[model samples]
Target: MSDPRHSVLLNTGSRMPLLGLGTGQLRGLENLMPAVDAALAAGYHQFDTAAVYRNEVELGQALRELLPKHGLERADIFITSKLAPRDQGPMAPAACQRSLDQLGLEYIDLFLVHEPGTEGLRVEDPQNSVNRAQSWTALEEFLSRGKFRAIGVSNYIVRHLEELFASCKVPPAVLQVEFHPRLAQTELRALCAQRSVCFEAYSPLGTGALLSDPVVLEVAKGCGRTAAQVLLRWAVQQGIPVIPKSSNPSRVRENAQLFDFELSQEDMDRLTGLDCGQRFDPEDPSLVA
Candidate 1:
């Protein structure tokens, strides 16, 4: 069983593991299986993926083959996937179904609107808001039908979330965005806390840039943990869930060892002090209307 201390209770009354394997650049069953095996052995019970990643089929296959080996069931693991921006609005229902079909699962644990805007449209297009509402409505319908146990959004700014709050029938259970020591996302985090939304972190390492930072290295050395672990811990220490992507088995195992140690308050403060609103992801949601 996953340690309860290492997981958080979501609004849906389900516990999501704090440390999850991110299957973003990891494609192919051969490549993904080992990483899944490593993660399971390391006590990770959640996996994050998206249709845009194009690895859902592989991830599903890996889990099916590896879960039994780890003596786990489908319900023991949390699977999070997203609806691609291109599949926004009217295409969302079919898109949600497609993810379920690809994953060979009856229902998804958590499903997110991948971005704030629609594909092939200008960022400031008014239709982006219209399509987002339509997509969210479709997701709500799926949630009602039990196709998705929980629903949320990704890369959404404060405005997008406020608008969603005003119009959505079901509030988002989680808000995932690019967050790390360099990009703290203070406003979004505060909003999520105020609304009881689980604020999740993607690109927690600043997409690998923070790994080489002198401050991160000093803290890692002080704590006898790795730079990756320090970065992930900084988030989970504050009740945030982090999905750090890595295909290497050793790194996957390394990333999962976060709960074994804790960072000092000073270390945490230094890390948070590194925040300068630097975003590694080039796709800025603020640009979307």
Candidate 2:
């Protein structure tokens, strides 16, 4: 990761690195510091975390110490966090403030509603819709107070986005969802483009489960790249921002080396043909909590 070769302009008038590190299931200084330190060493300025990640304090401290070591500052790193499912509705603002407190930052670069569904309420419940609308209003308050630069949603489909748009005064600036060559999310990407929302891909490599896919391997070999690079590049080339989490420094560096290579029409098409609406981690309402 040395000077990430590309950046995407966010709807909030900010430039976000197309390739960043995702901090999930990474908790405590023991687990987070090394990755954060290595990511910074490898030149990763963008990071994605969440309230439910239980590692915000660690992420915050790592950045606080590591940024200066890299000759960088808070302004140099773009951090994104999300609202937990348990914090939906009017409780959203409190959750936002809590995340701010956990990160020990004056302002957050980006904030997102973790899901259209929640922990306390059944995902299929009609109340989820009401909670979503009220949550958007609460998020707006957080934005107005300068707690965050931009606000968006995660795990949201077109219908969910439509609902958010219908009730929200400030539409979402970014939509974070699982995406990879095999899970292209074409219609959702189109929806975001149509609405001027920057679409972001999480698990761009399908949570490390798609790295060994036949198509990915073939494309990587033909391009003289790693499967991870091929997969991340696929999303970037399509104008979707991607965050691929890895604890290995080599893999982290490899993930950001996409700008140096270009995927030819043939390779691109082959990879595109791999899409079958498959997802390694499907959004299960039963597991929302």
Candidate 3:
């Protein structure tokens, strides 16, 4: 990894940067390369993308060129990609391989199901119904073959996890979710802790709300840090690995400069109190129908 100081060693014994660069919103071939290049230049070694993002080929090009030019190799970075909703079921493995081809990587550090059995677009159910159990079975085969170093699911609820536990043979190593001060996800956090699933929080800045919060701004002023820095620190202190997306060069560096400060118990409690179940990307159960 380029930035050793900002790394968070995961339970799988892999050292991933606590602050990952998210490319979910990054679009267009032109926008993708420069953003990725900016992130890499800022010393970010973890990149999060998905097949559905449709920028994998461009991202792959950026990585393949940028790393070698900077004297960095593939292993020097941790890359995560996901299997899309349509690519589930018996075709999941081949679909994963396709993603690998697009990423131009031999092994992915983490592979996740983009969403749960929503819309009946699972591998096991052809009737367009949510059949997570069947999809998970396909995930198991990928895990068993070491195609992915670690495997998990994204956007899963408590019920989804419960269902997974009831059916899966191997427990998930990580669970990626939309987490921030606004959407603290207390219940899911506690459940993951109980189950030994490392929770990785995406959009830890509340999709920019926390960055503009009055309370966060106040704290940032007092602490001599940006609101984004304060928010990132809050999540890191909670031991939740966070990936904050940014294409701006300065902002990318600012996001990674969060390890120096530690939030106090009082500060943590104060931040925790900001939670009101304000999920930026709240899942609708009816979508599963």
Candidate 4:
């Protein structure tokens, strides 16, 4: 038998592959396609992208070029895109269609609200939550129309999910967040799980922090893997689907070869102890409001 495909249950009651290629900071369009090429060859069938990444066009081109080489159809792959901040409200439906046009796809496997709330919304602004809830209602409509097979939110805190759940007809199918040992997000993760919502971790390798940690290095030495692999495997073993972004070809391949071994209970405990909830993302309270 071949290697087992690791999967996570989506809130749509579907099983999505646990690992995905994240296209966050792919700077230029030219450089983006090659990384996308490498990741596809490495068996990454799921892809995570957002409009803010500004590389959806490049990502679309790569998919068109590569999937044919592997004899895979569009449905063979799972593709995700997010709704941008400016694209909120009744206009979001049209924006989702535009994203589909950019990707050259009929339907997105998943669509997300890029953040909990839009930027420039201040504290105690009752309209802030109301606006986000309204945007989510639009997303829910898209889900109904089958434009997005699944709908979710990224960078949402527990409070944000709670309010959305209270106001919207559809709860988020997934929550994509910046989670790592340093920023454990245990409570938020648990809350999503309780609602049968899939949780995805963005920046799971601690955004290069794992590369320099002495403790992580020691663990990697013992495990005979690189610090990056150690950190990724830790997240996978914890049952969180992690998308670690890497433009380097070698690192892209290395990130995918993580299903072979299980971390020991002791090592898992040690990894958990490393959490200081250190967040790499700059504080944007607008996101949590």
The best candidate by TM-score is: 1
At residue 199, give the lDDT of candidate 2: 94
lDDT of 1 by residue, 1-289 (tens): 3678989988888888898999998999888999999999989999999999999999999999999999999989999999999999889889999999999999999999999999999998999999999999999999999999999999999999999999999999999999999899989989999999999999999989999999999999998889999999999999999999998999999898887788999999999999999999989999999
By summed lDDT, the worst window of 10 consecutive residues in model 1 runs over 1-10
State residue 132's C-alpha deviation in candidate 3, in Å: 2.0
**Candidate 2, run of 10 with poorest lDDT:** 280-289
Candidate 3 C-alpha lDDT tens digits along 227-288: 99889899888777788987676787788787788877777777888989787875643244
TM-score, cand. 2: 0.95
- lDDT of model 2, residue 201: 94
Q: State candidate 4's TM-score.
A: 0.94
lDDT of each: 0.94, 0.85, 0.78, 0.81
- Candidate with more favorable, higher lDDT: 1 or 4: 1
RMSD of each: 0.8, 2.3, 2.8, 2.0
Clashing pairs in 4: none
Candidate 1 to native Cα RMSD, angstroms: 0.8
lDDT by residue for model 2 over 1-289, one digit each (tens)? 2243477777787778887899988887887778888888777778999999998999999899888888988888889999998998878878989999999999998999998886777666888888888888888888998888899999988788877788788989999998877888888989999988999999888888888898889889988999988988888898778888877667777777878788998898998898988877766532332
Local lDDT at 220 for model 2: 91
Give each model a TM-score: 0.99, 0.95, 0.90, 0.94
Best by lDDT: 1
- Candidate 3 lDDT for residue 68: 73
TM-score ranking, best first: 1, 2, 4, 3
